[model samples]
Structure formats: structure tokens, C-alpha cells
Target: MMKEPTIENFLEFEKKYKCNSIKVEGMPIWSLYRYEIHNEIKKQTVGRTAEGSEPPINKKDLLTMALNALKPFNYRNVDVLFVCDGRRSKNADTGVYENIYLDEISKKFNSVILEQPENRKHSTPNGMDNVYFTDRVAFKTNLAVKLSTKFNTPKRKRYEAGVRAAFTDIFKAIKEEFGPDITDKMVDEMVDRMYYYEITKKYCGKILDKAQPKLIVELCYYLINNFAMSELGKERGIPTAEYAHGFAFPTHTPMQFNPEERISVLPDYHLTYSKSQEDEVHFPDNVKLVPVGFPFFERERDRYKAKYPREEKTIVFISALAEGEQISKMAAEVSEALGDEYRVIYKLHPKEFGYYKERFPWLANSKVEVIDNSENHMFRYLAESGTIVCTRTAALQEGIGFGCRVILLNFGDTALNLKTLIEKENIPLVDTAEEITDLIKNNKAAFVNPNGMYEPNAIENLTRFISEIMMN
Candidate 1:
């Protein structure tokens, strides 16, 4: 029998093939491409296609460049610089998209935010200065790269040709290892990503030259611009960090780095939600894990705890992008089986926001109250609910912190991803409505160590960590 393409098998293949050794322009290219390769592996494992949100193309590149030049903003000698993607949410009162990860942290210093544009209802609100958009940065970088290509020196020309040849050879080895799953087109995409990083690094290097920030931080460091910032910040002797955006599950590809791998680019520090998460990942020697806790979660938990009254019978189903269909059906079944006695809330993942109505038509007619807007705070729902249901969401940890017992869905990779919770907390995994209904009625909850998941004094810890790094 053929071996399944599980993470363990993939890791073995990666070690045997020495994928980390693959380089482009002195970069260990495997770190840049591993996420893409893992997505394919996951698709095959789950029998589902990967979900993606295509970045908007800057059509008016020249116009944007001109406007930026006309109203240039200064970024010289800043205390901290935060690079964030378009994952933002509207404040319940303000209705403006806020950077949930770094908004609080950014207030502690003379910080500058470089945010990507997203197709959202509102942009970052006024009053706070030093907020800059990155579409123009991307536009300027692309033009500079094109010009550099047009007028390359003799050595530069040779280097370009060599890089192309190197990718061709690397693709052959990748094809052999991954079988027909790896493709020539995918290899080409990776090559484009290679050039994108190098050019973005050069462009951001100029900004760093002016800013000379004491510390640099990003939400998710794997993205192209953020990864470039990490590499550049390290080269310039500036501290770089990535905030813990979600739980570092064992099967999570981006978090699963081999210690022996010669991965070139990484943030100097990983600011995690709690110290307990330190064991969840195997990071490179250069990277340090700091338990800074979660300021946003803490703030929300406290605010909503005061604002809302807990409904003991309310069940909130936290959805994951990949397992939306299955979760929706299960949540509906549980709601119907329980009838008017229970209040069920189904929260859709951000990726599923656009097409969920079409994708899950039953949700419209189901007894569950669907929370789809980014404005609706998840912690608010948690504050009001007594029990949480999920398959593979990081929110399960947060749910436990809110004093809610969990009912994990039995299907999919829930057992694999949440193995620790199942063992330690004794969370129940149920497939049928009868199991869910019985669990709710019995009300026999397991003890969960909330302090282990989220430490006390998050904002203080984060500020102190930043201060220490800056002083050092």
C-alpha cells in the first residue's frame, strides 16, 4: 500500500530531499514556497480545494505614484514600525476597520503603520497619524524592478540567467519528490515570488534607511512584504517580531519549521498568546518565543464580560474555512434537535463571508443565528454563550478561557489538530445531534486551566517586551 501524504510523511520527504538547501539569490527558497506546497498536500488529504483571496491589482499605478510623491509622509527615526495585511475588523461603535493585532501596541510608541488595502467598507479611521498605504509601495517597487531588468550590467545579466537556470533544476527535483501534484506552473509562480521578495526588500530597505526604527513587527510574517521586512530588519540590526495570530497547531504548515533546516528568512522573535504555546512549534535557533499574551482578546473579554449577560443554553459554533460545509450542517442539526430551548449562533470564518449564503443555502432557513459581519466581535458571542462547538479553530482555546466547555466535531482533522485539548481538557467529540443534545442536558463540564491558555497582564507584558528589545 502507498503511504499517505500526511505532514509526517511530508516532513520525511523534506528531510530526505533537503528542500531547505534550495536557494535563489542567497535565499533558502523553501521557506518562501513551503506554504504553497503544503496547501496542495492539504487539498489532497481533505479532498477539497484550497481557499484563496486574490490581492487587488493596482491598476492606476502611475497615478498613485504621482499622488504619493506630491504628499510624501516622513518615516524617519521611528520607535517602531508595524506591517499588517488587510485582515481588519470594524469597531462595534466606530464602524472603522481597526488593526486588531497591533492597534493597542502601536499606541505605546512613535509607531508607523504600513497597511495593505483591502476591499472593505471603510479604511483606517482618522485622528491617528503615520498610517500609510502600501499599494503605492508595491507599484513603485515593480517599476524599479522592471527598470533594473531593462538596464542590467554584465554581471547582473549573468546573475539573472543563472537564477532562471537554478529554478529549472530545482523544479525537476521537486517534481520527482511530490509526483504529479507539483507542477511547472506552480514552480513559475514561486519564481515570481522570489523576484517579488528581493525587489520588495530593496524598496523597503529605502524606507528602513529613512525610518531607522528601533523595532519592527508584523501580524503574519509569511506574507511577501512582511517576510521582506523581517529579512531587511535583521540585516540592519533592528529587532523584528511576529505576533501570534492563531494557535500553532502541530499540522499547521507555516508554523512547522525543522530545527536543522537552513531557513534564511525569519523574525527575531515570536510574540505568543501564552507560554504554553512554546512547545507547539519547532522554530529555528535564531528565533525566540516570547509569551506576550493577547491584548485584543483580553480587552474584548473584559469589555464584553461587563456588557453582556451569559446565556447558559447558548451554543456558538466557531467555523474554520476548510470545514465550513460540515460544521454548518452539524450546527443546524444540533439547533433543530434542541429546538426552542437553545440559542445557537453560527459564526462564519472571514474567508467564507462572501459566498457563504450561496455555498450553504440551508443556513438561511436554519434555526441558527448566523453572525457574518466583521464588526461582530467573537469575544462578545463567547461572553454570552456557555458552550462552544468547533472542529479546528484556534478560538476553542479562547472559548475555554471564557469558561465554556467544548464540544468538538468528530469529523475531519479535529482530532489531529486539537489532540492536546482532547487529552488535557477531556473535550467531547460528537458526530450526531443526540450526542450534542445529551452533553448540553447533562451539563457535566470538564475542568479547563484558563491561565495556561492566556496569561494575566498581556498589555503590560507586550509593552515591557518592546521596551526591553528597544533598549537592547
Candidate 2:
């Protein structure tokens, strides 16, 4: 049997091969390819992988992007440039997409540009001033690069040579480590990304030149566009920050980088949701981890608490697509053991909603009510439930803030990811439904104080940090 693919094994390979040292045209190409290589290795080794589908560019989204681009906004010399994905949730009351991470801080800045790639059905305009789109810019840049490759220009020659050098180094490392069986597939992935990186560089460079923003803030820094923007910001002496969107575990490869490498593909600052996250992953030495608190959780917790009064007999189980089977089975068993005394809500992750019934057939027979809507945020469920159950999810961390009793399912990465909370001994960990039943029936689990993890006045702290960075 072949050895199981693990992040530790891949990390070791990266260190031994000195993958981070590989570069093309002064940009760290290996960092951009690391995630791709990791996924490919897992797919070949395990015969399966979880790769999400990238929605194709439709006529409506393109039209929305065109309209957003035409809106008049001074893109020059802005205080900040905020970029986020278009897959946002529409605010029921306001009827506009909400950028949970940057909205509050965006209001603080006198001059800022809120840019998005393209509009999705779930995530449309936030009706805010100074909002624009960059899909057309990326489209044109990528198309131009594809059309201009036939000419034997000096710039094209330099690009080709640099790419060849980087590819040779990476292929040599992979061949040395894993042999030639998987080398071609991995190389093909890297080649595809090299072209994408060019698009990202030109797209980001154009936006930066036009805006000349004092600071750049982005969500989900691992995106190639955001990574390119960070490098561009460093080149221009402008600072870039990323809002940490999810929990970082030891298994997360994209967050880890060689501390010794001088060129960083990541943002200068990583704005985290809480102070406790610092202990989760070891990042590059220069990328500062700042705990700015999570205004979305804080705000939603209060709003949901007011809207839905807490029920002492309600239990909510947070589901993750990666661990869907194990988590759903546990939730079903617990529901059976509880015997209708408590109301159980199994909240499915957005990705799980489409095939959850077919994937987890037992859910249909289970007594628990499953919530599977994008608009119904998880924080709302956490606020009303007396107990929150989960294996692996950032929602477990947020559940701590809602003052709900958290029961962790000790399967796979759940215990590993939430190691700190487990060590604190305030939350209980159980492998079987009986253990969960006993804890909930007896009300034996203790709740941790939220302030220990999340800092207060999140928006104020974030805006203050932005101001300080702009001044320097």
C-alpha cells in the first residue's frame, strides 16, 4: 500500500527541496504553486480530492461588472482599497451584499475604494458609495497576454527564460522527491498557474497605479490576485493587510511559508479574528498577526440574540463538507439518544447543501431539523442554541462567543484544530453519542469567557491600525 498523503509529509518535502527559494522574474512562484502541488499529490495518492467548481462567467455577471465599472468614483490617491469575493450574503433588511470583514472599517475611511471581481447572484451590490469592479480588467489583461505570446519581443523573451528557469528548478525538486510518475501532472498545474500569475500581476499593477491607495486590505489572501497585489504593494512601498477569514490549523499549507525567504507572497499584516489564533499556525517571521477582533461575529451575536431568544432545550450541530459523514452520523445518533426532549438543528455549510441528502442519506431519517440556506447565517443559530456540536469548523470558535456550550467531536482534525480550546478544559470533547447525551442531559459542560479570545471594539481597533499604518 502507498503511504497516506499528509500535510506534514508535504511540508517536509518542501523544506528538503527548498521550494520557497524558487522564483520567476523576482516574484516567488513556488508559494503560488504550493497549494496546487499539495492538492495534486493528495488526488494521486488518495484517488480522490475536494476541489470546488469555479462558476463560469455568465452574461449577467459580466453586465453587472460593466455597470459597476462605469460608476464614477475617484480611484486616485484613496486612503484604502478593499477587495473581497462576490459570493457574499445579501442583508435581508438592506437588500445588499454585506462584506462582513471590512464594512465597519470601510465606513471609517474618508477615501476608500471597494472593488470586487464580478457580481454573483447571492452576492450583489452593497449599495455603498465608491464601489467598482475589476473583472473586465483581469479579462482584458489575460486575453492580451494570450494574444501577444506569438511575437518574439524582448519582454516576452525575458518572461519565457525566467519561467523556464523556475520550472526547471521545481521539476528537478519533484523528480528527486517523488520520482517521475506524478511530475508531469504537477508541472502542467504549475504551467497553467504561471499564465494566471501573469494576469494577476498585470491586473493588480493596473489597479494600484490608478488608485495609488495608501493601504490595501483584502479578504482570503491565498487567491492569486490578492497574492500578486501583496507583491505589488511591497514593490511600491505601500502596505497590504488581509482579514483572516477562517481558522488556521497545522494542516493548512497555504498559511505556512519559509521564514528565511526574503520575498513574501503574503500580505504584510494578517488581521486575525482573535488573539488565540496566533498559536494555531507558524507563519513567516515578517508577516505580523494582529488580532483585530471579529466585528461580524460581535455584531451578529448581539443582533441574533435580540431577534431569537435563547432556548435552553435547543442544540445546534455545525456541519463541514470535508467531515460531513462523521459529523452527520454523530448528530443523528445524538438526536436519537436525546429522544425529542431537545430541538436539534443541523446547520449545513453552503457547499454541503446541494448534495447533502444524497451524500448523507441517514440525515433524511434523522429527527434533527437541517438548516440549509445561505442567507441564514451560522451566528444566528449559535446565539439561540443552548449547545453547539462540531468536528471541525471555525464556527466552533465563534460558538464560544455566543455563550453556547460547545461539544467537540474528536474525529479527524477537529481535536487538532481546536487544540487550544480543549486544553483550556472549558469545553468538553466526546467521540460517541452517549458522551454527548450525558453532558447535555446533566448540563455538566462549562462555558469559556469570550473576551479571552476576541478583543473588544473590533472596528475601532482595525480603523486605528489602518490609520497608524497610513501615517508611517
| Per-residue alpha-carbon lDDT of candidate 2 for residues 1-472, written as tens digits (9 for 90 to 100) | 3345577667677777777778776667778877877767666655434444446555665565566556444478788888766556567667777777776678788555445463233255676766665565555544445444545456655656676666766666554554445655655445556667777787678777878889989888877778788888888998999988876776677776656645566888998877767776567788889988878777777888888888978999888756777778888988998988888889987777767888888889989889876676677788789988887677867777788887888876667666766887657888888898899999975577655657778878888899999999
Candidate 1 lDDT score at position 435: 87
Which residue pairs show collisions in model 1? 77-211
Highest TM-score scorer: 1
Off by over 4 Å in 1: 45-50, 55-71, 119-122, 138-179, 444-447
The residue ranges of model 2 lying beyond 4 angstroms of the native Cα positions read: 1-9, 24-27, 43-51, 55-74, 111-122, 137-181, 444-446
How close is each model in CA RMSD to the real structure? 3.8, 4.0
- 248-301 per-residue lDDT for model 1 (tens digits): 777777777767765557888888887777777767766888888888887787
Judge candidate 1 at residue 97 and give its lDDT. Answer: 68
Residue 261 CA displacement from its true place in model 2, Å: 2.2
Question: Candidate 1: worst 10 consecutive residues by lDDT?
Answer: 118-127
lDDT of 1 at 186: 57
